[model samples]
Target chain A: MTTTASAPGRPAPVKPGRPLRIRRRMTPRRAGSIALKTLVIGFLLAITVLPLIWLLLGSLKTQTEWLNSPSWALPENFLNFENYQVAWVDGDIGRYILNSALATFPSLALIVVLGVAAGFALEVLVWKGRGGVLLLFLAGIMVPGQMILLPLFSAYFQTHLTGTIWPLILTYTATGLPLTVFMMATYFRAVPREIFEAAAIDGASIYRSFLSIAFPMVRNAVFTVALVQFFFIWNDLLIALTFTSVGDFQTIQVGLLNFTGQFGQVQYGPTFAAICINVVGILVLYLFLNQRVMRGLTAGSVKG
Target chain B: MNNVFGNKRAVLVFVGPALLIYTVIMLVPVLWSLGYTLFTGSVITGFEFSGFDNFAKLFSDPKVGEALLFTLKYAVILTVGQVLVGYALSLLYVFWLRKASSLVRTLVFFPIVLPTVAVSLLFQKMFEVAPQNGIVNEFINFFGLPSVDWFGSPDTAFLVLVIMDIWRSMGFYAVLLYAGLLDIPEEVMESARLDGAGGWTLIRRIVIPMSLPVLLSSIIFSINGTLKVFDSVLALTNGGPGSSTTPLTLLMFRTAFSYGDYGYGSTIALLLTVICLLVTVFIFRSSRRDLTKG
Candidate 1:
């Protein structure tokens, strides 16, 4: 095993069954190692994050500058706020944002409310045939949304729910439900029996115990489910693309695709600006809820 | 306490909303699509009970064959690329990246949140032609290689889709596998290390085996997800340069929506669903076999 005292840029070799504990004293070799790791990971991070940064910078460039200059070249005017204005006005991005929010928030709220309720029931309440019902929802996890797209579209058309935000909302809620319920169930089930039993002795109803005790016990799961559902609905293009016919009802993703499909080459500035804002909005949200999102995504693999 | 906790009405109240929504929105649609396949019609012409006619047509459709082959190829490419890159990055995280891994993981996973259209647009900008050649092409030209039209050909367009899909998703796999790796008890790792296990030997014998379930889960996940891929490819290429990159989902969407061939599209959708289900079951069975044997 290589020791940090001897080898620069090598991670401290562990013995076994122990977390990688950071060394306190920095020898010259350790310092160099730290610097090198920093540089390498910094480079990797740069590769990952810089494209979006470049896209933001590119958004600021005039159409000619964007087409003419090296992608890295600083824009002629740093304060090209007009490009964002154009993206908002000409590209119809604000409406797309509004549509995305309309589609996403309702779905997110429904996913949480329903997910928490179902999770509590399956985990806390003694219900008959819970396993069978759970296996049913588990099967939903295997379903590809494409399989349902046509029939759902037909059903929506039959019911006259097409071309509106409601179809989008309903589908998002439905598709998001299985995983939300699954993830929430896992989290709620992990809460100790003693906690619930204590609440029950106070004569709390299952619903009341869930709200007062189990919900707080699984706040992280709530965050995880909400954040994951947010990304799913926020980034969904297929539902909006296929189900919604009204242009005004299209989500930001569909709107961007349509914008890029038509004006991508000729109107480069506003397109990049639109992409920039879309990326920035999601990136900001991700940053704020980073841990919960990661937990949600990785929740499946970690849980049985 | 037991009385309050397990009251039948309370149970109903707790689980009713999600079960209802899930049934109507999710589960019903699966059965509905299966039902739709039995009838044939256009949105305009109205449906008639056609009785496996759509499936009959699907059997003879060369386009169906092409789309299936393309989807299989696409799924294989994405699943391999995503998992391999993810595994490599996971190794990097545990072995070398260490503290810097957090930021790298964060940076990598950031793409998972972006709108698929946004990612496709950015990458499209990166690969588009001159006078505003994408920076990638520009970099290639910087090395003085002749300009290559990436999306101009079937092969390159497919390659571009694969690469773009990998970029958008590889981070997700890395984080996923990394979490799995961290779950391996350090004693197993250290003992493996102490017993002269290093490099490939350590990862192969210890890390990978310990992480097999997660590995299997990810493979199943990426493959099925890739099989059903639509939004990214739709945004990136729209199955174009002449349907070269069209997956089943895109084909299904176009057939049903664009051509208004509701029956045929439903048929393709059913095929894709079956493919996903088959792949999932096969992987689960194989992983179980591995568990028992290895």
Candidate 2:
């Protein structure tokens, strides 16, 4: 999985007979260089990691402590799950998480299935006017969500789907498709056409060949596309905000926004805790899928 | 093979659902949005064709002008920060850290996946001034300086917004440009080094030109993404401090949804679309011209 993820634009293999450069002896210049590198790396690490740690610590603190204590102070008790309980129950973060999942997962499934099919037809299958069709899809990528927001809302309002998760699912899937199809087409184009031809000669149906041959060949692309779209759908605020009303099918982001407005001033601990809940959910997923996520994101941008 | 693969029915099966959904949900709404610019009022009030009145109103609206200026300023600053910082980090990853940069890259990239609301809350607390001093104020107090209200004024709020966004996104750009850097053959660096090209000279003459395509891609990607800067600003500032920080998207949302003025909102949306298209074309044309010149 890792190998395939990094396959696109992977560094070239070193040439044979290339002389390996010897490391220079420890000198003042080298020492200064190392020192400068250490300073820069350390600064980057500190800026990136410290706020998160501070947030974690803040979440563990009691409300009184959060209000009175210095921001950098450690929590008096690390075992205080009181804020977590308040956040999960009172803040209704769990419901928002479920709502986000409800919107995100179905969107991912649609994007992948539809995207792969469209990509395969556009790139792999012998077809006429695929170029024009592909360009149409690609052009959708440039259309800002703002351009479609008012119309979508108006349409959803008329259809009486304004407060449901349907709008989010449909819009996410549709907007996500342009990139998904483009990336999948890029991936599917790399697969040899002869294999699909061979399968057809062996009496395989188009669906059969796509399912058995093309899909497996581009499994990495599927994962890449899925992960990329997962981040997008999961972290989206605009479509989610526009489609769903407050407290009814509101995704985690909108919920968090309302949560902050409600509790941000008076209840610092639970508010931070609520924010932590959102961050921790994404962090857990990212930890598990970081490599794939990184590779997938880079592959799309670098190659596309 | 030709008969089976080239079947029109199979092609429709493959492409029908996606195209249908894309057209209905995406493409149609865009055209519809353009059409709405000719009408006034929301669905509840019933849209009446006013025929270019929205355009006339859009040109004269002072708030629209403010939002446009803010949007352009925000996009330009954020794009530069995102791409430049990302390029610098990528350079650091390739040249300085090299084989040992993966962990740093991963750590830095963590924030990119974080939800915007969560990051905004964290930044709010970090820079909070009213209820109690946050960490930033704590540090200032430690230095015997007065606590700064980071979000109190428009300038400071915008500053915080810029910092938060750059911090959140630079890592992704780093990894992006890093991928491009990897594709630069090691032999090129080796040969360049052998010719006494070191430090900025090697980067200026070799690395920059070699990685120009990805850099250009990053610039375009960053600019377009920034120009559509709805979520981050929405979450961070909510275009507060008297709408000084409001981008066109948020204003459009407010106009259409909050104020029930769909026609003017769509006009604003059209303006944004035109700006994005113009910027993209400008970048592409200039880059192509540069490529030819070189």
Candidate 3:
């Protein structure tokens, strides 16, 4: 076999004598390759889907059925709402979900507004210390949340912000900024400088150009940042666990942990039901926006 | 354009709010935590200065050693699994599935968005060997193997944690690396195929070298992430049957919050930060050397 180095950005010389194959010819080797690929992919699909199915089936079962039945056994009634009611009411999952939304949306808004503005200015405008500022934000990404947990918790406690959603909102927004601003800067940098110049020549102020021209151009980046941060803040447990002490202020992940600790053993059905609620909430969002979610989440890492 | 864009007030308006918030909430706390390393008490008892005592305690503390060992072991195993499995899956997506891979990608990526606590609960039930065997054990029995009590021991519990976390996160790396793989020009692949480079040869010679940048980035990203793992392990094992599965982050959390040893906890936090920084620098240095040599 010939080994050839195909470095990117250098065009590989095409051999003139070789005919472009329009279709792959079937052979036993190819057939075996196809079989192996299918088997492996099928196994991956099963592993990914089966546990979620188990959760769904378990959620619908009665306690006796859940305990005694085979692990894969389907629930007798698929429409069972009893566990759902128990989880929603007794577990207070609904309230926790609302609290999660309360914390997430406001923080997301702040991250976007601030990230976009900073990203725009840092990348588009003439500024002296922009590189230093960007470096500062980038460095924040490496600081483990562990480092901040103790001090932030104490600060929040002293300021009487421990029991409220402010801690969650503030922490998420602040932590979310580095990546958001970095991503938005990347997006803004891709916009040609001439567009901003044209806007300036049209007598548009910096704010006016940013609001009308630059912002609309990077709406996709905004969406990406918002969606990524939404999932992050929503799925977070550590900060939520640390900051919110009052039951009324707890986010869904924290609430789920507490609910499972309390009801997981004796009430398997409702426990599974509670997990299913959180899963389904995210599953709906993922299904609706999986493409963008996938793109946004990968955008920052893959670009490097 | 320079005059319009260079207004100092506009620049401040654009950048100051984020800078201020990030400084106050994120940056200041890191400095504050660094300062806390010198003091030796929680807020309740009031801090007393004990210069470098916490650092002294960190070296001799057996629990810290065990937690550090667990964290390193977990990070190594999980990073390998996440990156290798993800790379393999991305190869499938690009080479085999191609345009038809989106549905499978979507299914695989589903778990990344699910709350870690929720997924941990599901895994706990799936591996339960107590009152009744979970599906895993049921499968083991189907093959005439004895049911394993997965969480009954530290080793088995660690295995379960690794499997659950890899399942949850490999999709993310797959997606990340998939985007990188997609950047390989079609002509380069076609040319390689013409030269009789197939399968492993094609990937090793062309694809791997071309995608090394993203692959290395993925490795760094995965390593740093696995190093700081807290939520998944917390929800899954809560530091486990004998504190055997506890990572540094969890140890730090318990030290500060539960044990009220803020100074020592901050020291632990500092250790983690240094480890992450070293790992990143090491990878970059090594990769840079490789690039130059190649």
On TM-score, the leading prediction is 2
B179-275 per-residue lDDT for model 3 (tens digits): 8899999899988988999989999999999999989999999899999999989988889898999999999999988889898899999999999
Q: Write the per-residue lDDT of candidate 2 for residues A158-271, one digit (tens) a residue.
A: 898878889999999999999999999998888888898889889999999989999999998798899999988888998888888633899999998988666746688888
Chain A TM-scores, per candidate, are: 0.85, 0.90, 0.90
Off by over 4 Å in 3: A1-19, A22-33
Local lDDT at B56 for model 2: 89
Native-contact fraction for each model?
A: 0.77, 0.78, 0.84
**Model 3 reaches what TM-score against the true structure?**
0.95
lDDT scores in order: 0.83, 0.90, 0.90
DockQ of each: 0.70, 0.79, 0.71
User: Please, what are the lDDT tens digits per residue for candidate 2 over residues B1-294?
Assistant: 678889889899999999999999999999999999999999889989999999889889999999999999999999999999999999999988989899999999989889887898899889988788899999999999999988879999999999999999999999999989989998898899999999999999999999999999999988888889988888888899889999999999999889999998999999999999999999999999999999
TM-score of each: 0.92, 0.95, 0.95
